[model samples]
Target chain A: MSREPIRDSVADLLADSGLADDGVLAHALESLRALCPPEAPEPSGALADLLRYGSEAVGAAAPSRAAHRAAEAAAGNLSPRVAPAVPLPPRKLHRGAAISAAVIAGVGLSASGVAALGGVDYSANPPQAEVRSSAAAPAEADASVPGQASKSPDATVHQAQAFAAAASGGSVAHEQPAAPSRGASDNALAGDGAAASSHAVAPSAAVWRSERSGAARAAAAAADDALAGIGRDDAAVTASQGAPRHRADSAPSRGRHVAQEAAAVAQALVAAGAEPIKEAVALGQQVRTVAPSLAGLGSRH
Target chain B: MTDSLTDHDLVAGVLPETELFSRVYQSLAPAVLGYVGARGVEDPEALMQDVFLSVLPRIGEITGGVAGLRTFVFSVAHARVVDHYRRVERRPRSVDYDPLLDMRAVPSAEAEALVRTGQTDAHLLIGSLKPEQRDVLMLRIVGELSVDDVASVLGKTPGAVKQLQRRGLKVLREMVSEGVMAQ
Candidate 1:
């Protein structure tokens, strides 16, 4: 005769989470032991017990003394994990690197470790020679040269105001944020020098739905984007503006150039106001005051 | 017990070192084994041991005391689980012939446990759920990690962890109700 056994898993589940104190989840999973049921192998030795509960908790058996030895032997030099030393291949210069190195060696280094040969030496302090250009370069539409407004120390204040005017139109326009997305400025207002048409209005909301050609609509949208310091998408601009898609003469390029000048002017003003360079600007004022006496002395000699 | 100890307090009170690592291994061994084993990692015990070997180097420097150690340990275990599947995908899962692994010599737990009865046990019951539910349950129940720790270890949000936990518990609760009704 054989006896049948009963095992209810729902009972098992309740019993498993019976230790869970998590108010709601307490009956779900109370303790960790439910995960590793009694049917799992009992740790036989200390080494194996490393993957088992502490020997003290289970009270299964006395931890074998060999466990310590095995752990130490197994774990020897395990701390401060060092990467295996990979055999590095012999160092050889690539063709571009070889050519650059050859060129540098031919030029050699000055005592200051800058290249003795002629390309720009960025490490040197900026040239302090008085900017003598009677007219500014066309980088700036209003003043031409960016830092030219600061021709003398007295011109620093005017330089800052000029930057603000160039960037946002004036002090009042500066107060208002440049938000093209908000439709604050409906037409070309960036003062881009090459804005072709004064009449190129931002299309009204209904105009996009009207039966206008795609090129006409896109050109109007592209003009608005160009003036707002937004995208410089070559394809969109080329469809409307007569300039080649990628050329610097394009309306997008002119807008970008104007923005670049505004930023340059801002940078020059910041450099003029920086405390590190404050003393240098003051020295310029001192030299200006002393120059008349030096001229008289030179004339008599 | 660790709730009162802030991460800073735990680190301030104890030095990170080998002794702490031993304590960690002693505490987390069972959980790691159950977690990796349930996830169906190849050679679960060996991989569990490898997790410790990796932790050995960081033994002294591990912070947040036991809770921090558990999170760190489980994070490694989770990564190893992912890596195991990745390896199985990249290369055909093959191992050198070992008699110990042969089913003819030794029947597996699932093969012995409920295959004979056609009844689902806890492992099979938990396994029935989706991977996310299973991960949340395993990390919550076996690893005994808080929802936030589970989120960090699993790289999920706490809300997501909570939702997964709720769904998993609901499935298990339904199974329990059904089993009771059948009985």
Candidate 2:
């Protein structure tokens, strides 16, 4: 039932086997035999034993689920062994010290308030009225100079006559023509009735007063000349018959005369065309009025 | 009885571990051992353990049963032999000692003398050949590897391996015939 290669195959195999029961082939085989392990007659048997042991070891050492579960439980039981962190105690809030501090602060504020109010003048009127009276004193002085000038017209006229007589070589002759014209203008101004009425309210009250004064001075000079001419006739009669009546009249008239004289002198000066002196006097008066306040300011500095 | 049952079942059943593993070890171990033993290794058991230990881990890779194993074991054994030879070659040369006269392990004077003479013959014969020829011969005869395996290991063409083998054999034959070495 099996196919075979003929006897020729056997002869070929025997020839290649190189076995005269022992030949080069035997020597080659012997060389291999010599290299074989002394204890392992068959190297393949040892290899098989190793393989069996390895397989059995793998099979016997299979992982167990119970062991795996136990390991998992042990791992799960391992919580971090954490110590409890101690809490810090609450801080004490001292209200007593806080209230004391607030009271000190309130007292400080109240002291500052009392210091501010203490500077106030509560029950006393200040010296503003006294200051006002002192401030009015310069204006009173200006008024007094006008009154004094009204009573000195005759003296001023004589002084002016003297100066004119001296300058004109002792011929102190009055210009009677100029007198009538001046008298007519003065009467016109006085008759306006408005100028006389507005003596208290006129914005040009100083000019009106000055012009009235000039007319009055001219009238007084005329009266003084008449008297002087009468006195030239009889010294005794001039002194006795009219002297007492004249003297009584003179005292009353003297006040009017003095006012007229001062007016005359001012008119003579003005007629002499010296407005520069008038302006200088006005400016001098203004400077004198402002001088006291200036002194007060200097002292303050 | 259970071991017998397992053995019988293994031999007869689907997975034949007893037969497969047993055949692998039995058929191959001797060739590997003989190849290693010829190299004058004193401890053949250690070498045998190494070869099998290496092979056992990779035993599942044998695709074709005996033929696959034959190729693998021989290749591994050859690698092991080459490794052993390289290590031996690296040993220090006897400086104050005589290598020929160091025969303390030899049981008899005749054997000692023979080994000394063989050593001399080997030195002369191998020394006379070209380095390439000697390499080929050593890989073939000492390493116990086939010409093809030798070519693969040496990274040479099979033609070059054949050429080197022929030259080396020719040189050895000439040396023996010229009586350059004692028979």
Steric collisions counted per model: 4, 23
Tens digits of per-residue lDDT for model 2 on A1-301? Answer: 0012112222232233332342332232223222333334543343445456655543443323332332233223322356659754433346667789899999999999997776543221223422332243333223222332322333444544443333223444453222323344445335444435543454464664464444334433443542343233224333445433322223222223223323343334333323233542343244333433333332222
Top candidate when judged by DockQ against the true structure: 2
C-alpha lDDT (0 to 100) for residue B130 of candidate 2: 84
As a whole number from 0 to 100, the lDDT of residue A191 in candidate 1 is 35
C-alpha RMSD over true interface residues, model 2: 14.7
TM per model? 0.37, 0.32
RMSD of each: 29.2, 37.9
Q: What's model 1's overall lDDT?
A: 0.47
Give lDDT: candidate 1, residue B94: 73
Chain A fold similarity by TM-score, each prediction: 0.17, 0.18
State the lDDT at A86 in candidate 2: 71
User: Which candidate should be chosen as best, given TM-score against the real structure?
Assistant: 1
lDDT of 1 at A225: 29
